[model samples]
Target: MNAPQTPGQSLLEVVDLAVDYQLKGISLPAIRDVSFDLRAGEAVALVGESGSGKTTTAMAVAGLLSPNAAVTAGGVRYRGRRLPIDDDDAMRPHRWNDLSVVFQGAMNALNPVQRVSKQIAEPCMLKLGMTRDEATARASELLELVGISAERGAAFPHELSGGMRQRVMIAMALACNPSVVIGDEPTTALDVITQAQILKLLTKLRRELNLALILITHDLSVVAESCDRVMIMYAGRVVEDGTVADIFNNPKHPYTKLLIDSIPDPSTGKRISRPIPGDPPTLQNPLSGCAFRSRCPSAMSICARDLPELGAHEQGRVACHLYPAPAEARGFHQMGEVTNIMALENLQVHFPGRGGMLSNLFGRPAAHVRAIDGVDLTVRRGEILAVVGESGSGKSTVGRVITKLVQPTGGKLVFDGKDMTSVEGLALRPYRHRVQMIFQDAYQALNPRHTIFDIVAEGVRSLHLVSGHEAIMQRVAKSLAAAGLNPPQDFFARFPHELSGGQRQRVVIAGALAVEPELIVADEPVSMLDVSIRAQILQVLIGLRTQRNMALLFITHDLPVAWSIADRIAVMYLGRIVEIGSADDITFNPKHPYTVALRDATPKVRPMINADPLPGLNGEVPSAARIPTGCRFHPRCPLAMDRCRQEEPPVVDVGPHHQSACWLASTSQHS
Candidate 1:
């Protein structure tokens, strides 16, 4: 391969890099012809779906690739010198001094046994040849640089918050003052607010220290918010590369456009059901032409005959046959009349917390953890109502209560205009048949020992919904076919482990459909699946809701997912519904401060370039055992006033169908 052109004195350059993992005698190519340049103090982001070779490319660059993996072609160069990444001894000097890495999970990356200060000081003492006392002092200063208190440096990893732990990792990465930092999914598995804070911190440090940063992430919003340049990878290849503004605004590649379109726009309440049709090509069994030809919506005959080169387009460099790109837009079908199918009135689910033995002996009443406190919600037939919140916000609890998996401690649950909160024994049997649940982890929810047919048939058998051996089989086959698992007979005998993530989720959905429930409580059903498959599962749910006229109570933490699929949204905060309205009302004209923070924290592609750090919440969610006295969100609310701290706010009607439990809603609305 010919060498690529470099701009100025490139700090780091990757030219036609290729990597493959060897298993037995077979070689599976994980990265192919991946090349990019990073200048001093520049921020570049590698964005793509999971298993799209983003992580593999970063691992290769950092010399952290697995032993089974080998670089087949090209080289990684730092300051025009070829890096011996394959040779550990040769790369040792450049590891931390010239380049460093902040791994994905900070909690798992840090040493739990050692003090954070000691962990941060180790590199300084060993690499920089500093004294023990000097290293300790330097550690404190590094912590301060990341906005952590110097005194907290002595704390253990577990004692610090998620954001603090990440900050400590950043401090450690900067210990030897590395010129370049590669962060591999640095903000993965973090809350939205924490993600924003970390992104802001990374951007701040990049400018302050004049360090080049390579952010490897699946989240496009983070890339748009933090990076100067963007590279979209797919199946081990750089499909698109250009300035952030150029790519996001006018994406030339079909895959790049799909990714941007898939991101649920908080300003628009439209569900994106047009998922890329096929799975990514298997690298081991090398496909002949374009890797994305099977999934491309605008694929031509040439796409299958010849692979497209990463040639320059008007906007940027794109690997596609269709460009100047043709506009390809899709829309969803409208639902029928909205009639309330299920309602929760002043619902409360309080679990009694256990006290010490002394308190028990003294007959002291145990304190209660108000999991769901006076949350009034409704689900209309054929409509998707999403309950969104951070962890421990009681969104899942509400779903459980609706499905009767966990009984509510107080208030009423009305279904089909009938009060069924207090009903028990045989009287409650019908309610169970009318409401079903779809769990988040499809692998865990499904029994490994059971076959696909047995899993789906179990529900029909237990409820006696169908009779006879053949009748049950017919019912199971029908449900399976409805869930997009066509040719049901083919999948009937397959085990849970044998199926893909998307297929397993389909099995779970088939089981729910077997019961023919009027309302389905789906709790983060697609969170574990890939972004491409997530759209498929969401499409299945939306189709079932529209075709079956069933009400769906969708509980999730992802704002974009909620915006994409939900007709109405209920934003939960510390067990209460802070905001409830149509998706448009909640997304476009939010009234509550918590809702606003959530929207702002969500990364989205802005029309113009934004240099400002994304705004983040002040603190983590408070403990459910000891929630704040008045408004539970007041502690971290940006619009919190004295009255907010003093009293619990009443739910005020902010719009036609919008209600917000916020005092500031009365004075000023936050959009």
Candidate 2:
């Protein structure tokens, strides 16, 4: 094995790498013609939506992918030597001290039965030839570097939060002080605050230790803040490669532009979303030309006839015909209206925390979290309503309350024609037929052991809407087709465990629609999906809503996603709706400082960060157990005035459908 770089030298180089899976009847490629470089002390981010071959590339780099998927062609050179990669004996020497990987899904990746300390120490002891005691001491030190305390070392993987488990992953990957580290979707399952901390720790470690890093993610913001260079992959191909600034400021491909436009912004009146329609092609029989041609807004005839090579355009490389050097694509500025639903008066919901069953026994939370406070909103028929906020901003809580999953503690909750704030038992059970909730993680809601037929049929059977197994099967087939799970016959026989993450999610959506819900409560439904797959799933939801004139209660953190489908928008902070209005006013004319900060934090290919410093929100949000005295967001609000500290602001009308809960917007406008 080679040693670390001496001063200035490239640490790793992968050239024209390709990986293919061989089967009895097919030879499918997973990664093709991928090339990138990383110098000592430098970082390169491999960015893409799910199924973009990013993971395949990482697997090749870390020597982890299954043998069935072989690196048939191309090169993975390290420190100028043809990699000792084929045999385990040749690869083991370089596995940890020279290179390592921080896998995504830390919770699942860690051994459930193992103690945190033991898990972290195993790799250190095995790879470094250190004794168990020595490795344990090093593991604690590594844990401290990534934000966890030494005390957590004794805890089991199940005892830790998602963020804590991820930190353990980072600690273990760094236990042997590997020179090159690759992290895949490192923050996918964590909350916004925890994600920030993980990113900060990764950033600090990279700079201070000069370790070469490869961050694999679907998030553009992570790339903007952490990496100097980036590679964008799509359907087993490297579509673009360049410096972070070059790619963001001069995105040359149509797919790249759409990917960037799909993020949501949270700053004024009402925000709109324009999610791309259609799913990516199956890898089994890939199309001849550009893989993105089917849904590309600027696609030309040339794209259908030829596989547009990842040719160069401007400073970076782009793999689309439209970017033949004079590419111009419009994005993120398009938004969609309420034709029917309205929420009247205001709604409030509070939940208790860590209280005994007796506290819940008393008909209240002994200690609680005020999730939705005095929120009045509407969702018109044929329209999409988006609710935006960072995690713990009461966004998901709002969805739960609307779906009647949680009873509101106060105020009116009038739906189509009924007061729903206090509904219970039979009334609520029937409402489940009309209003359904889509959870963030499909796996959480899906029964992994059951076949697709049983999963989707659960809701159908509960309602007792169908007669025999034959009739239930008919309804299941129809629902599956509606969610784009074609060949419903084949899919029904497949279990959730046998399907991909995206496919499992489609099954969940199919289950939701089986009940024939008129109003769907989508709580970060697409957050766990890959960027490209997310757009497809969203488009399906939108199509269903348009056809059925259904109302949507969308909750998410991404602003571009909201702009694509949301008819109107609502921004929540802490437990209250800070602002509500039309998509246009909110996306373009944001008044509240908190809204401005939230929007500014959003990362885009061409970020709106030309002149002003990208706003930095400070201080952790107060724990729900003890919220701030005044404005919940005041501690981090850059525009907080003296009045903001002593008193809370009331909602003020800004436009025909826009209102903001900011004292500044109220005082000047009213006067």
Who wins the lDDT comparison? 1
- Cα lDDT tens digits, model 1, 345-386, are 999999989987998999998788899988888887667899
TM-score of each: 0.50, 0.49
Worst 10 residues of 2 by lDDT: 327-336
| Model 2 lDDT per residue over 284-394, tens place | 757656788888888787777555556556677777776552212111111121234447467777776677687667876465777776677776654578999887788
Residue 124 displacement (Å), model 2: 96
Model 2: lDDT of residue 113:
93
RMSD of 2: 28.7
Q: After superposing candidate 1, which stretches have Cα over 4 Å from the reference?
A: 1-337, 357-363, 605-615, 669-671
Q: What is the TM-score of candidate 2?
A: 0.49
